[model samples]
Target chain A: MRAEPQSFDRVLSSMCTEPHPAAREAAERFLATNPGDPGTYPTVADLEDDAVSLLGEIAGLDEPAGYVASGGTEANVQAVRIARERAENGRPTVVLPESAHFSFQKAADLLDVELRVVPTTDDGRADLEAVRACVNEDTAAVVGVAGSTEYGRVDPIPELGEIADSVDALLHVDAAWGGFVLPFTDYEWHFGHAPVDTMAIDPHKMGQAAVPAGGLLARSSDLLDELAVETPYLESTSQATLTGTRSGAGVASAVAAIEELWPDGYRDQYVRSQNNAKWLASKLESRGYDVVEPALPLVAASVPTPLFEALRDEGWRLSRTGDGELRVVCMPHVTRDGLESFVADVDRLETRVGLEVAGASE
Target chain B: MRAEPQSFDRVLSSMCTEPHPAAREAAERFLATNPGDPGTYPTVADLEDDAVSLLGEIAGLDEPAGYVASGGTEANVQAVRIARERAENGRPTVVLPESAHFSFQKAADLLDVELRVVPTTDDGRADLEAVRACVNEDTAAVVGVAGSTEYGRVDPIPELGEIADSVDALLHVDAAWGGFVLPFTDYEWHFGHAPVDTMAIDPHKMGQAAVPAGGLLARSSDLLDELAVETPYLESTSQATLTGTRSGAGVASAVAAIEELWPDGYRDQYVRSQNNAKWLASKLESRGYDVVEPALPLVAASVPTPLFEALRDEGWRLSRTGDGELRVVCMPHVTRDGLESFVADVDRLETRVGLEVAGASE
Candidate 1:
C-alpha cells in the first residue's frame, strides 16, 4: 500500500536502505514471543536493562543514563527540557547551528528556550567562532551537530567541547545522523569522550533499525537526574523518552542491529560507505555539478532550482537543502553499478533538460 | 534477548502478538522483493491519491486534509500546538483528568500551557462536573479520556462535548487505549462527530497493528491547517501528524491487521476480552480486592501496599497506579483460562506473601 511520506520514514530512507538484518530478526522474535506471565519477560526491569545496555554500547559510555523514545525529536525535546530546567539566569538559550535539524528549533519552541542560531560556513558546517561569541552565563546548553542535516557536514565537536568547557555549560550533540556511522568511521573524533554531556541517536537511520527507535546517551547521570520528573507511567528508574508503552519490535530491532554491527562489521560498513561517497562525489563533480567540500557519505550539490524538476522528470529523488542545494546520501545498499547508472541517468537528463551547468562559464 | 521495556517496544507489542502471522508474510514478501530505489517508489502524487481515496472511505469529506506522524503522542502534540495557535484569549489552559495519560501533561509542559488537573471520580472516570468547571475563557481545549491509563475508564464524552460547546473550546479525546475497542462496542458514541474536535488513536494498541502506528482524527480540517508547520523535511499538504519520513511497515502491518480483524473478528475479539476482564475482575473482587469503577475491558485492583510484593514473588508483573492501585488490561490474546490462572495465582500469592485480605481493617 502506497502512503504519504512521513518525516521519520523519509529520513530513515534518506539515510539508509534498511536496518541491519539482525534487528529485523529481533523484531520478528519479539513479535513471535509472548511477554510471559509477569516477571519473566517484558517487565519494567527487563526494559530498563535493555535500554541501559543498548545506550552503553551505542555511545560507548560507562553508564547509559537515559531512556529511549520514539525518535531523535523526543530525545532533543528531553534535552531541551533539561536545559530549560537548569537555566540559572534569564530565559534559557539553546545554542545550535543554523543548519541543524528542525527538531532543535522545535524543542526550543516547545520548551520556551530562546534558540540562538549560529550561522554555518558555506560548506554547511557549524561555525564554532560564532558559537563562542554567542555563549554567555545565560546559556543552558550548547548544541553541536555531529551531522548537519543540509549538507551532512559534521561540526567540530572538539571545538564545541572547548567552548562548552570555557562557558561551563552542557554540550548536547544532535548526532541523529552520525551516531551510528561515526563509531564505524576512522574519524579521530569522539562525542562521548569530549565535553558533550548528552547526545541523541536514531537506530532507524544509519543504525539500520526500525522506525521509532531512538535513545539518548548522556555523559553524566546527573544531567538526566536534573531533568527527571516522576509520573506513574514514566519513572526515574526508567528512561522513557516518550509517553506510553514503546514499540518492543523497534527496541528488539535496535538491539539486534547494534549486536550485529558493533566494533567491526558496522565500522567496516562505514568505511566502505565513505569510500563510496567519495567516489560518488567525484563522479558527480566530473559530470559538472557543484559539489560541496569535505564530502561525507552524504553529499550536497548546488544547482539551479529547475534541476530538481528535471531530475524528477528523469526519475531521480534528491532532497533539497535549506540553501537551495540538493542532497544525495550514499547508503550501504548503493552499489557501484547503481551509482554509475544514476550518474548516467543524470547526464542524459541534463542534456535533455538543457539546464546551465555550475561553473560552465569557464 | 529479554530487555527492559521501551515505549517503542510497548507500542510494537500492543499491535501484535508474538509471531504475528501477517508480519511473517509481510517480512517474507519484503525479503523476496527489492524495494528497488526509494525514489522509484511512486511519487508524491500517487501517495496523495491513495491518501485521498482512503480519507474518502473514512468520512467522505471534500478536500480531506491530514498528515502522517509516528504515533499518537506526536499527533496530540501537534493538536495541542494548533489549539494554542488558534486560542481565543489569555494564556492557554488545558483541562484533563489526573487519570488521563501523562502525554497531555507532557504536551502542556512543551507548549507552556497551564494545566488544570480536573478531578476524577473514585471509579477512575473523569468527573464531568469538575471538567465543566475547569473550562473557562482561558481554556483552549477540554481533554476527555477514552479508556484512561490508571483505571481504563472512558469518561462521559457527551457531557464533555456539551461543556466544550458552552465554553467555545475544542474537545480532544485521547483514545490511545480505547479507540480500537470503542468502535467495536455497541455504544452509540461518535468521537469524530460534531462538538468533539479531535481524537487520537494508536492503531498499535487495540488494533493489533505494529508499533509506531497512531492516528489523530479531527472533526474540523482547520485544526490540521492551524497546526501545520512548514519544515523542509515535511511539506504541509502531505502530513497529518508530525512531519517526517514514516515507516511503511507500520502502514503495512496496520492495513493487514485491519483487513484481518476489522469486520467481525475485531468485534468478537473485543467481546472475548471484555468477558475475560469481567471474569478476572469478579474473581479478584471475590478474593476481596477493591476494584476500580466504570468497568471497561481493563481493570485496576486497589491492592494493599504489601500485595505488590506478594504478586511479584509469585511471578506476576504489573504496574501500580498513582494512588496505589494495580492496573491490568485484558489484551486480545489473553485467554479466559489465562485470566483464571492469573487470578488464582494472585490470590495464592497474597496469603503466601503475608498480605492481609483486601478491605481488612488496617
Candidate 2:
C-alpha cells in the first residue's frame, strides 16, 4: 500500500536483496576457508570452472563456454561492446527489434554506436522484412529478443540468423528473461539452434535464481577477445566476464540453482508455469476480458480504465506497458489458485470499467 | 574435504545452510519479497527510509544521502564516475595511492580517464608529497585508500584532503575493506574528522554481511548529479546506482546486517580480527620473515621466491600483490590457533626459499 523508492537507495537495496543468501554464504565461506586473496586455497578460478560446469548443465551447452556478469544489463552491454569492437570501424550500427529490451539501447549508447530498431508484427513477432532492410555493411550486430519486455514474445530466431548471415553481422539474442526458460519449454530445440552468435541469460528471472546474476554465452570464443582487458590484478583468461570481482555468491547460487533443477526438474517447472499462464488467460477471456492469447506466459489485458484502478485498490499489482496495456508476467512462483483469485478480483472490478460480464460475457 | 560453495544456493532451493541463524532467517525473509521497476512491491523508498531509521540507531546521517551499490568495486566505480562527470571536460584524471585497490584502476579504465598513482611511504601509507606532486589542474579526483588492498594501510585522509583542496579536486576514499572496522575502532573520530568527499564501504568485507553489497556515501547530495542516465524505462533519480533491475533480497540483507551489527557488535568483530592479525604478524616477525608492520586486520609478508612456491606446494593459499608481497586478511571466523599454524608453516617454507634468520649466529 506504501510508495516505492523514487531514489537510489530503494533501487540498490532491491538489487542487493535478491542474492542475499548466496552472497552472504559466499562471503562467509570465502572468509572462513580463504580469508585473504594472498592464499592459494580454492581460488576464484576453481569457482569459475565449477560455475561454468553447473551453467553448462542448465543451458545444455556442451563445452561449458561462458562468463559471469553483474546483471542482464551488463551481459547485454558486454555483448554490444564485443560486437562494436569487431566492427570494421568506418560505420557501426546495431539492429534490434523495437520490442527489444532497453538494455540494448543502453549498450549502444555506452559503446557510442548507432541503434537501429526494426519494426515488429502486430502479434509481437519480429518483422523479418524490416530486420533485413535494417542490416547493411555498417551493421555490427542484430539483437533479437526472446521474451520481449513489451509483449513477452519470442522472435523468430532462425529467420533472424539467416538475415544476419546475409549481412555478415553478428546475431545476438537478448534472452535475459527467457534464456533459461526456453531450455525447458516446448521450444527447447529453438535455443542455441538457430546459430545465435551470443545470448544473455538472467538466472534471477524464470531461472528462479538470485539477482545481480546473469551471463553471456557466446558460440565463438573470439567474442570475448574484444572485451579482454589485461591487467595485473584482474586477468582475462579464455573465459572472462564483463566486470571483475563479481558477487561470487551470485555465481555460487546460480550453480546451486541449476544443479537442483538439473535436467528434468527445471523442465517440469517451466511446464507448470506455462500451464498456469494458459489457465489464467482462459479464465480471463471467459470473464469477457480482452486477453492476448497464445501468450508467452505473459498476459497483457485491456479492460476499461476505471476497472484497472479498482483492481489496484483491491491489492492486485499489474504493470502497464508503453501502449497502455496491463501486463502480468507469469513467474515460476505464480500459482494456479493465485491466478484464480486474480481473475475473480478482476471480475469484480469489471463493472467499474463498464463491463457486464456475468451474463453477457463473450 | 570438499569445498563448500560461497553460500547456500537460494535460487535452486529455498534452503539455508549458514552458521548464523539470524542471517539465514534474514535471507529467507528477503527472498520472499520482490520489487518492481520502481523495484519490488514494497518499493525501495520504503525500504531505504526504514533502513535509514534502523541504522540511524547506529551512525545515522543527518540527511537522507547515499546510494547502494554491489560491493566496493561498484561503489568505487560509481564514485569515480561522479567525480569524472563533474570535472572540467578537458581535465579528467584520477590520482590515488599506489597501494589503492585494483578496482580504482578498473574504474578509471572503464570510464576512460587518466590514472596517476602516488607512491606509498615505508609505513605503507600514501605519501602526501608524492600525491601533491602528481596532482595538477587536470586532476579530476584524488583517491585516498583506507585499508589498502595490498598492505591494509590507512592513508592520512586529513592530510590528503589538503592536497585535494589545493588542486581543487574532489577527494574520494576507498574504505571497502575497513569502513565498518574504522567506525568502531580507535579511528572512529578519523572518519568524522577526515576531509574525504566520498567513500566506498563494503558491508560484506569487514561488516561480515552478505556479498554483492556496498554503499557509496558522499559528503553532499549534489555530488550524485553526475551518475545520472536518462532512459524511457528508467528515470534517473537523485540516488540511482550503476545498473537497473535491483534485487530486493540484497537490500533487505544489508539492512538486516547493518541493523543486527550494532556498534558494540562491530567493535567486538573488529577486535577479534585485529587480534588474529597482530598474533600472525608478531609470530612471522619473530621468525625473521620480511613482514610489513602496523597493518590492521590485513598483514603482508615477503618470502624468498622459492619459499613462496614451497608453501604453495604444501597447499597453503595466500594472495600476492604487484610487488610479490603475500597478504593475510584476518576476519571474523579466523582462530588464534589457525594463525599460529599458518605462521609455523611459513617459517618452515622460509628455509626452502634460502632465507635464514639474520641473527641466527647470535
Candidate 3:
C-alpha cells in the first residue's frame, strides 16, 4: 500500500535512473499544473515549448516542432500516426528494422498500418538492402534506430533516409536512448545529419529528467498539424498531443534537466558511462565471454543462463536479449564499482558451478 | 524557460485542483520510478494495483481490472479501443452524446471508427431515444457521460447500457470528473448500479491527486486483456497501458490521496462545493442571469459576452460553454470566499459596462 522507492544501486538493466536534482524540484513545483490547458497554466505550457526547443538542440534541429509526450511509446505511436495521416497511398505501410523497439508493433496495431520488419545485419545494424527491398509506394514511413534495445547499434540512417525519399515516405529516427549521448559522439543520426522527418527522444533516459519526459520532434510545424484535433474548451484552439490534460511536471522537469545539463554536463556524464561500459565489456571478455562492443554506453555479453540467474539472485537487476545475451545498460546511475561487483558475482558463480565454456561459441 | 507555477487562485473552470498534502509528498518520493517496468520497481508497481483497487471501491466494482493511465484521454481512448478489439462487427462505429468530451473525437479518428453523436435533452442529459436509435450491429461501443464537461449532467446510464446490450456493444462511462464525488450523491451510474463494462475516472480531477492520475477500470479482467500487447524485454510478458515508461508518481499520489480522503473527506468537500455552486447560481439568477441548476457542483450562467470578457479581464480565470454561458466548476480549491470574490468581479463588470439584462432571455 506504500510507494517508497529503493535506491538505484542494483538497477543495471533499467533505462530509467535517479532524476537530476533540478528535475525533481521542478516537477514538484509544477505537480498541480495541467499543460494540456495551456491558457490556464501558461508557465508550464511555455516550458513545454522550451523543452521542445532544448530537444531540438540535442537532436540537431534549429527550428524543431514537437511536444513533450507521456514517454517513448506515445512519441513513437504519434510519429506513426502522423505518417499514416499524411500518406497519399492507400493502406499506409511502414518499414522498420528488426532492431526497432516493440512500440512500433503497438503503433501498427493501433493505426492499422502494414508493418514491414526487415532483417538486421550480423553486426546488429539494419540491413539497408532489405530495407530498400521492403519499401514501396505504400510505405508511410521508414524507421532507423540510433540505439537498439538489445544491443547498442546505430542503423545507417542517411541511407534509410535516401530509401524513404525514393518512395516519397518519411524517415523517423528513434533516438529515445541515444539522443542525449549521440550529440557527444560522431553518430550520423538526428535531423542535422540527415533528412529525418521525425524523431523520438527521451529526456528521462540520458538527460536525467524525471519519467514521462519523452520528446517527438519534427522537421516543421506542418508535420504536427497533421495530428491536430480541435479542442473547443481549452486556451488553444487545437491540440496535437495524443493525451489530454497531461501533467506539466514532465514538461517543467524536462526543461530544468536540459538547462542544468545541456552540452557540458551531459558530455561529461556520457564519457563516464561509456568508460564504464568499456570496462565492463573488457572484464567480461577477459573471462572468456563474448561481449558486444560498447556502441553507446550499453554492453551485451553471452553469459550462461544459470550464471545470469545466479548473479540476479545476488540482487542485481538484469535483463536478457531475445537471443539470450545478458544485457547491461551503463546508465548515469551505474558506476565502475557496480560493474566490478557484478563481475565478481559472475566469477564466484562460475567457480561454484564449474560451468562449461558455452559463451565462447558466440 | 522558467516553469515556476502561478497559484490556482483565480482558476474556477478547470476540473483539476491542487494536490492533497499526502499526495504531493508521495509523488515527490516516487518521481523517478517507472510502474510500467514492474519487475524493476516492484513497490510502485504494487502501488498501482492498490490504486486500482481503491478506485474499484469508489466505482462500485467488486473485482476491478484496470491500470493507472496518463490521463483521462488515454483511458477513454483505450476504452474505445477495447470495444473495437472485442467487437465481432466490421467497420466499428461508436455512439456518443454531444456532451461527451472531445477525447472521443480524437479516439474515433485514431481508431478508424465512425462516431455518431446524438443530441441531449433539455436537462443536459443524453437523449435515451436518440442513443437507442443510433445503436446498430456496427456499433462497437456506446458512451455515456456521468459528468459532462460544459454542464455537469449525468446521463441515463442504465438505459444506455440496455441499448448497448441490444447491439452487443460495450458501455463506457466517462466519470473523469465525477467519480470522486458521485459516491456521495444518489446517481445510479456506476458498475454496481448498471452493467457498465468500462469506465474512465481520473484521480487528478476531483480526487485531489496530482496531474496524470487517470484511472480506467473494467468489470472483469477479460476486458483489459483485449488491449494487451506483448513486451519482449521486460519481466512482465504483456502490458495493457497506452504509454510505456510512465512516472510512478501518479500511481503513488492517487493511492495516497484516496487513502487520505476517501469517504469522510471527499463527502465533506463535495457538500461544501455543492453548497457553493448553489449559492453562486442563486446570486447570478438574482442579477437577472439565467443559471443552470447546480447539478453536480458545476454552474452555467447565460451571461453576456462583454460582461464575461470583463470578468476575465479583471483577473478571473473563466471559460464559457459552447452556447456562450459562463461556466464554473467547484474543485477542491474553490471556496465560498473565492465565489464571493468572483461575484464581486461580476457585479463590478456589469456596473462598469452598464449592461442590459441580456441573460434574462434564457
Q: Mind giving the per-residue lDDT tens digits that candidate 2 earns over B1-362?
A: 13563332111110011223344344335443433254235554356455434332333245534655666777787778778777886548999888887667656545667899888888888888899889988888899887777777888888888898998898888877777777755543133565677777765566655545566777667886565554333222222466655545455656666777757777887788788778877887777778887457777777666676576566554446567766666766565766666667766666545544444534
- Candidate 1 regions exceeding 4 Å error are A1-13, A32-60, A184-189, A233-239, A303-307, A355-362, B1-20, B23-70, B88-90, B186-189, B192-194, B233-245, B303-308, B350-362
How many clashing residue pairs appear in each of the predictions shown?
43, 35, 0
Q: Predicted chain A of model 2: TM-score relative to the true chain A? A: 0.83
| Best model number under lDDT | 3
For candidate 3, give the lDDT of residue B157.
90
For each candidate in turn, the TM-score is 0.86, 0.83, 0.97
- Candidate 3 regions exceeding 4 Å error are A353-362, B1-3, B355-362
Candidate 1 residue-wise lDDT at B316: 50
Shift of residue B188 alpha carbon in model 3, Å:
0.5
Q: Is the docking of candidate 1 incorrect, acceptable, medium or high quality?
A: acceptable
Between candidates 1 and 3, the one scoring higher on DockQ is 3
- What would the per-residue lDDT of candidate 3 be over residues A144-228, giving only the tens digit for each residue? 9998888989999999999999999999999998888998888899898899999999998988998878999999999999899
Provide the overall lDDT of each model, using Cα atoms, as 2-decimal numbers: 0.63, 0.63, 0.90
Candidate 2 lDDT over A168-213, as tens digits, reads 8888887777766677555532334676777777776655556556
